[model samples]
Target: MDINTICVHGSAHKTDYTGSVTVPIYQTATFAHLGVGQSTGYDYSRLQNPTREQLENVVAALEHGTDAIAFSTGMAAISAVMELFEAGDHIVISDDLYGGSHRLFHHISEKNGLTFTAVNTTDLLLIEKNIQPQSKAIFIETPSNPMMQITDIAEVAKIAKAHRLLLIVDNTFLSPYFQNPIDLGADIVMHSGTKYLGGHNDTLAGFAVTASNELSEKLRFIFKTVGACLSPFDSYLLIRGIKTLSIRMERQQENALKLAGWLAQHPKIKAVYYAGLPTHHGYEISKRQARGFGSMISFETDSEQTAHQVLERVKLILFAESLGGVETLITYPMLQTHADIPASEREAKGINERLLRLSVGLEASDDIIADLEQALR
Candidate 1:
């Protein structure tokens, strides 16, 4: 079936109860046993839930994966995957990553004995040089966090395969509608379903889908044991959010392109980082890999004070930490999202205080552009 059809009806079928067109929320925490040692498909909410199962299957099918596991938050899903690595194992990651991801790898994972090296994965040579003998996996976020940097998934996958390393790609920015990393040979594809997958700020969820059954089984075990499963109520909201993902993303992409173009021409703007822009370093690769350029955009202002001024002045866009919702959001990565990282390190990576990131929404492009124009003024 086409992606559009799958979006609306992939994992759900007309149920006998009320014959509702929409999938009804299965709110029970546990299911009763049919007989002694016999049971229904769901034993407990943490292990499984009908509503969450529908969401899992939908994401799995959408991403072309063998199976999918949903989590309470994006960080939880990431932690579960990282747990597969042993104490001595090393991880190679993109330098421009989500702030929370950096914290998890540099602080939390380090405490657990898992070492990591942050490198520019856009350059395969840099990645190859940094791979240690004990390196177990490579974690990457293409069109990375605030930088809009892109890495060739197929190229990285080839290098990972040669080194017998697992390849995990965070598909949050592009979402399943724009990019399917599994199709490009990535072993695992992950998303902060709180963002694009949920399509609203109402719920928080995360998910991981694996192309191979072996990897799926391993992740499933970790997820079940760790108990980071998403709740049934949020699962219902996520599924509903996904139904209009294509439409919402279309508007968002349109708005983002227009905004990036405008920012690039602005006098106060030093640089605009967006895959949609012709001059963006990642434009070609993003064009080749993704169905669209995506809604996230970032720009460097003349000064930190100016950046904050622009954010404060924008009336239509909310100044918030999260992204990929129907309403636009603006954030300072240096302070809001990546604040956990050391100042020197963040500055070195160009996550400066003068940088502003925007998650464009489904609002009118003209209104968004006008609001930004006045804010910049």
Candidate 2:
């Protein structure tokens, strides 16, 4: 079935005799049992809700995963994934990941005795070199946050298989409409449903999709145990948001490519980091593994002053944190997303004050480019 079809009808889990075209939000906290030892497939809202389950079903189908667990936020979903590793288990991760993931590993997970090594996953050799004897998994974010670095998912999956390690991919940037990491050998896929899946910037939600039933059972256990499940209303919003994901992503990518080309030619722009650009290091690899270049783009301005000026000057593009929404959002990694990392490390990764990330939206290409034009001036 086409992804667009799945996006539209995958959540059609028939729950009642209402014959409603849309999945109804099951708002109750608990279900009444017919008898002792009897069940309606759901006993409590914390464990599972019909609305959230439908949302998860759509995400799982989109990612080609056996199951997906929805959470209150992306961080909550990530936290549950981290719980899969025990104390003293080490994981090799992409160095240029979202700052919140970095904060979780450095401050929270490390304190719990889990170890991590951050390396450029694009370099397969470096990934192998950094793997410790106790390494349990490889977590990576292709088209990595802010920097837009792309790692070959198939190659990394080979490394993970050879070493008997779990492969987890953060598919937030590209979303399932553009890429399905599980099909490329990822054991699990993560999504910040608040972004592309939600389509609108109105809700907060997250998901952990498992490729295998074993992993699905494991993550689900941790999910219900942690109690960070998404609310029923938010689940409904996500479902509605996903219905338009195909169209939204298509428009967003079209605008992003136009904006990226314009930025690359601009005198004030030092460099544009977008996978769609032929000059990008991972352009070929991205083409081989994904369906689209996606809508996220990051560029470095000629100076910190120029970057600040653009952030303050943009009228159509919002100066805000978070990406993959209908509204175009420009973010400063140095202060907004990657601030948790130390200054030296952040600067080393080229996430300096001069760098700005752009989340192109469902706006006209000319209008989006014109907005940047005036801002760059």
Candidate 3:
């Protein structure tokens, strides 16, 4: 089936006794068993819920994974994956990743005895050189947060296989409509479903989609044990959001391409980091691995003063954190998203005060650009 059809009807499970088109939210803490031993496959909400299961199934289908585990937020999903590694295990990860992920691995995971080596995953040699004898997995976020650096998934997967390590790809930026890391040899795919998968800023959700049953089983055990599963209502919200994923992604990318092009030509804008732009460093790699460049655009302004001016002055384009929604948001990553990182390190990655990240929404391109035009002036 086409991705559009899948997005709309993928969650239609066999247990849908109701004639309604949408998946009904099984809003319950526990389900009564047919008998003491017999079960309806869902005994508890924490272990599983009908609605969340439907969500998991649809996401699994989209990512071409064996199964997907939904969580309260993207961070929860990542935390569950971290539990898969034992003490003394090391992981190779992308350097320019989300601040929250960096904080978790550095503060929490390291405390638990796991170590991480952060490198620019875009360069295969940099990744390979940093791998340690204790390395158990390689984690990467292609089109990494704020910076928008693209890593070749197929090439990275080959490196992981050669080293006998697991390959985990964070597919939050591009979403399944644009990229399927599993198809490119990722052992596991991660999503902060709070972003594109939800398609709206109203709800929070996350997912860990596994390529094999073994990984699915492992993550499921950790997920249920941690008890951070998504609520039935949020699952329904995500389901509703995902129904329009195809159309929203299409329109959002359309708007992003236009905005990126305009920003590149503007004198106040120093550089535009959007894969859709042929001049972007990651253009060819993104083109080969993903269907579209996605709706994220990060641009550097002429100075910190200009960056602040645009944030304060834009009317239609909101000055806010978070992305992958129906409303265009312009965020200052240095203070908002990646603030936890040390000053020197954050600035080194180009997420300084002069940088702004834009989450292009499903709006008329002219209106968004016009708002920026007025703001820049």
CA RMSD of each candidate after superposition = 1.1, 0.8, 0.8
- lDDT tens digits, residue span 231-308, model 1: 989999999999998888888998898888888889999989999998988888988888999999988999988998
Residue pairs with colliding backbones in model 1 are none
Worst 10 residues of 2 by lDDT: 10-19
* Candidate 2 global lDDT: 0.93
**Tens digits of per-residue lDDT for model 3 on 46-163?**
9999889889999999999999999999999999999999999999999999999999999999999999999989999999899999999999998999899999999999999999
Query: lDDT of each structure?
Result: 0.91, 0.93, 0.94
Query: Which candidate number maximizes lDDT?
Result: 3
At residue 50, candidate 3 shows an lDDT of 86
Per-residue lDDT tens digits of candidate 2, residues 212-313? 999999998998899999999999999999999999999999989888998999999989999999999999999999999999999999999999999999
As for lDDT, the candidate ahead, 1 or 3, is 3
Per-model clash counts, in order, read: 0, 0, 0
